[model samples]
Target: MFEDGQVVPRAVLDSLLCDAAISRYIFGPDSQLINIGRTERIYPDELRRAIIARDTHCQYPGCTAPPRLCEAHHTKHWGRDHGTTDATTGVLLCWHHHIHVHTHDIDITWKTHPTETSTEKHGKRSRKNAPTGHWEFTDRNGNLIQ
Candidate 1:
């Protein structure tokens, strides 16, 4: 049921569950209603910030939309794949690309790089390396996007 109390189909509910705030309902004995908790964000602030820092911009190929204009997208969907809501499984995508990805069923594969310590002699920073992780996009047909 919606806030307007209009009953909808399960498909509508499933779609909302995929990328919406969720409220965990607690129960009591005798199946009595107990508590209705506040809705929780799909991606928490810290994890979202980490993903934004790592991505820096939209991960959809040449798109350069900054983190401010992007949203955290789950490479492995939480509802579909039971994916974890962590930096390792998230990426930054602009609104257009984010919607495009989900609409067209684009696949995202995340590859992680090990943390490398600087080998500099003094306290100077070393040359910057790749990000902690990266993602590759593929179409539904399994063809990689350039």
Candidate 2:
């Protein structure tokens, strides 16, 4: 699903639905949870296209990875009960960096800074927020990269 660059087919979706139904029938209603609302609107095709165009690659600084290996990350996680799902609260990140951003207490700041030419540069930067139990990424030369 990640490599083919194709939308999920209906047959596979049907099979998944059947499996879930069988599980629910055997285990009981509490075994399955259903989401019936506008949550799916957040992952529309246009949003994916916008993510690709805006970020171009992984938004993690110094990472040259492409979009195919990355995911559109929501800065504010979406929940069934929570109401916010705006475009500004999203970023693109590769799998490793995405997990790192969520699992650790990392501070991510999205702002505009002045460039050498005195022009504004807008982007996101990560800083370690925890005193301990924090994750770090380093380059091959044993220097910290993130």
Candidate 3:
């Protein structure tokens, strides 16, 4: 049951109960309950915003997609430690590129280059390349160009 202002669709509520029943069958009677007393919150909104501002767009090299289409990915997995969840340790990437970054064992290099002159403004960092030889840009037929 929910408060007056809170609403849940009947279909969604039914699906949740169905899922709980399946989980109980697989993991025993206690599986449907959550033990949250020791859980820690990671990726607070401040950190998320910082990550968005720093990356500005997808971190995959040559990917022109903007941050609005991207997700914040921790360089180190969140399950490993809290340090990995910091905004400075994360990168923004679009869904397709995010999968490539995590699942393909691709190597990505991030670096900062200095500005030529102070009046020229501070130089921003960038991703140098994608580990695979495929170019980010391709022809209509999807052939990579040298």
Candidate 4:
């Protein structure tokens, strides 16, 4: 699932999906999140793996919640900001911190690749978010969250 590593077994990826570790996320060369059709709040499989790979644990900085328990959270609320279901717009947050993030107005910023070109067709429902590369956290005041 990574750009510079050995291929993850499809079985592992399937298991992660069953465990709900995959959420809205990234993808590899054969496919990209920018090319998937998104349903209202449901993540396509590729997106899910991308998120699981991006965050091996709850992405709340100090939280150690396992990936299987995390749900995809939009750094920008989907309804409120028209957030896309892509890694650049998503973060993995466990149940507790997920609630906290929303209530506290924390901000998650992802590093992205705006110039990367892809041959896949962009989904009509997909937001035009740049593909996420890496990420950082911040608070409402723009100070680092951790």
Q: Evaluated with lDDT, which candidate comes out highest? A: 1
- How many residue pairs of model 2 clash at the backbone? 0
Candidate with more favorable, higher lDDT: 1 or 4? 1
**Using TM-score as the measure, which candidate wins?**
1
What would the per-residue lDDT of candidate 2 be over residues 1-146, giving only the tens digit for each residue? 53778876543432232112111111125642232123342444455566677678887767868989987665544432232333344567787777665555243434554333223346654444333212234443556555
Model 1 bad stretches (over 4 Å): 1-15, 23-41, 112-133
TM-scores for every candidate against the unseen true structure: 0.63, 0.47, 0.46, 0.59
User: What TM-score number comes out for model 2?
Assistant: 0.47
Off by over 4 Å in 2: 1-38, 80-83, 114-146
Steric clash pairs (candidate 2): none
Cα-based lDDT for every prediction: 0.71, 0.49, 0.47, 0.64
Q: What is the lDDT of residue 7 in candidate 4?
A: 92
- When 1 and 3 are scored with lDDT, the better candidate is 1
lDDT of 4 by residue, 19-106 (tens): 2322333446775654232343556666667888878889888898997888877665554455555665768889778767766767
Candidate 4 residue 26 Cα shift, in angstroms, is: 12
